[model samples]
Target chain A: MDIILSNSSDQPFYQQIKSQIKQAILRGTLREGELLPSIRNLANELQVSVLTIRRVYSELESEGFISSHTGRGTFVSTIDSELIRESMRHLVEQDLQKVIQDAKAYDISQAEIIDMIRVLFEEDL
Target chain B: MSTVLTVKQLQKSFGSFELHDISFDIPKGCITGLIGVDGSGKSTLIKCLISLIRRDSGQVEFWGMSIDDAEQEIKNRVGLVMEGNNFYDNLTLHETKELIENAYPNWNEMIFQKYWGCRDYHYSSRTLLSSLSQKEKLIFSISLALAHNTDLLILDEPFCGFDPVDCSEILVMLREYIQDENHSILISSPSGMEISSIVDSFIMLDDGELVFHMDKDHLLESHMLIKGATSLLGNIPVSEFIKLDIGNYGFTGICNDYNKIKPYCADLDLTVERTNIADIMMAYMWRRGNVI
Candidate 1:
């Protein structure tokens, strides 16, 4: 898998790593049961600390997107379709909330904001 | 986490300079950096850790074994690379390597030969170490570390005299060495910006005390630089900013905890910028003197 990091970005480094891996898994770029990079290897590759990578793996495992074997290594887990859908819905809901907030800030009416969303939704299909 | 080395309440004194009750762990599989300005006890602490200068008091342990019990084992397993030529000034590179070969039982002739040909290093073996430049000296020192089958590497001020490219070259080499979870490294340097990108955790020192220690991500996430008009300072709590500085144009300072002041920042329409390692350490330094 490929990953990119920016030191100057506002986001924390660990969060950047976690999100990139999650996105890759969700987008089907990474296959289930595929062995992931060892914590030290990944840390070296990214020029980050092994602790940070360990935290990333732990977070992924807790989210059920990956799992680790004691002596072997970490691997992607079989993801649930329901979880994928729920995660996507949650992301979109957050975006929609921001859109609503911006609309309200710009003095747009609730009905007008809903109408705009409807138009955008139809266009997306 | 499995700790490779633990220094508990390590203390040392030399007239006016004293390292006061410093304790930290070098966990396996991680690169830990000690950052402090000159005379901040970075070198003293490292000297004590390696037993070059005995600590006045405190316990140093490796693999749960005390220093007294594991001195030989620790010497065998831990490699030290300082940016200086403590070897005989007249000895050639090959001669020096030959002398130290028996000291490290696991030393490989082939591994030594591999690093001997580093690009632009000209470690042709016949060249005397005393004639080498600062950068070459450091490269040779680190190459020696790599040649041994050491699990833990200790470095002190290895980035002092080098171009940016050379500094990065050293950083990359160190990173590649710890690709396995069995190895660890502890490095000390005054230039936080140079090694901060590669270090997993950071320990900050000022005067003789450890001002703070933190994970890289946590340090960046916890604090931020807050800037606004000096007049706006009245709206926020005096204690909110760790080291507040006011200017005629405006005011700029650091908020110690971004999470705690996020709502306060929002309520006052203030901007909180992400803190860099250098700035974070500087903020603490400012707090110590309580003046900027």
Candidate 2:
């Protein structure tokens, strides 16, 4: 999997790693059951400490993005459609709430906000 | 974690200088920083690690297998970038990458592109190493090292001669590489000011001998710069110090217990400052009379 880090960015190192792996999975760049480079190999390749890498892997594993087998190495987990849809729906709802809150704070009516969003979609199209 | 590299009683002598009784394990997936002065044998230890130079006496194991038995396999898994541009001057950046790619079994092109973009190394693959600027040369070398995707990256002064932007970019790349948990880095550089904060642990060498091997936090907490009048120096017990340097204004030393000495120093009206890695290294070297 391709990963990049930004030291100057506010994001922690592990989060950068997690997001990259997550993006790869979402983009289908990393296939289910594709074995990742071992933690030591990744650490050495990246010239970083193992502890940092271990934390990333543990985080990924805990999130069900990857699974590790004893002596076998880590692999991207099989995609669970239901889980993915549920997570995506939750995220969209949260984002929608933020949009509504922003609209209210700006003194924009719901109909105006909806009209603006429709115009944005038309521009994109 | 499995042991990637181990050295026991590793003794290497270069005329007057020798790395004595150096024993350490580079646990799998850990970045181990070898910190020392120019002549303190950091390079010698790295050379020994790669078997570029023969050691007088020592045992080395790579991946739990003896180095003697698995030299080729071990070398295959170990990526090394020493001081200077080790690549051929005539070869283009692309040529260098091709050469390394052919040698290593696990070279990854996608990761190479990502690191290249992250480092902002914009040279075309065909750009000759001879034509590149010094900073470009360093970035190219780093890219080639990461592209190979080795189990361990042994870098000597990887950040030398780069501007702040380039240095920061390289640090980001290094952090990303270690995120995979299978990689580890062993880097030695005289300019530890920038990268010390990110390093996991430090191994300090003095006069070709291992002086200190400890985590960064412990080193910062344990060592101190004790400043007091020259007369107060005699009153302070010598047993509390690991090494001491007496200056005209005051003295600085590596103390075993900072708390124990704090009260005595307070009574003596002396000032104490917590030591940083650089200061501790300087004082330690000064005590050893290695600094000139």
Off by over 4 Å in 1: A6-10, B117-125, B290-292
lDDT for B38 in candidate 2 is: 81
For each prediction in turn, the share of the native Cα contacts (below 8 Å between chains A and B) that it retains comes to 0.69, 0.19
Q: Write the per-residue lDDT of candidate 2 for residues A23-86, one digit (tens) a residue.
A: 7877788998999987756655554544667778998888788999987989999879886676
Per-residue C-alpha lDDT of model 1 across residues B1-292, encoded as one tens digit per residue: 8899888998889899999999888788888889988889898888788788889999999888887777888887888886465778899877877778878888876656665554435556578878887776777777787677778888988888668998997787787777767888888888588888788889988988998878876777777788888888888775867778889988888877777776677667777777678787788888888336
Give the lowest summed-lDDT range of ten residues in model 2 chain B: B215-224
Q: iRMS of every model, one decimal? A: 2.1, 7.3
Using DockQ as the measure, which candidate wins?
1
Off by over 4 Å in 2: A1-125, B117-121, B229-235, B243-254, B262-270
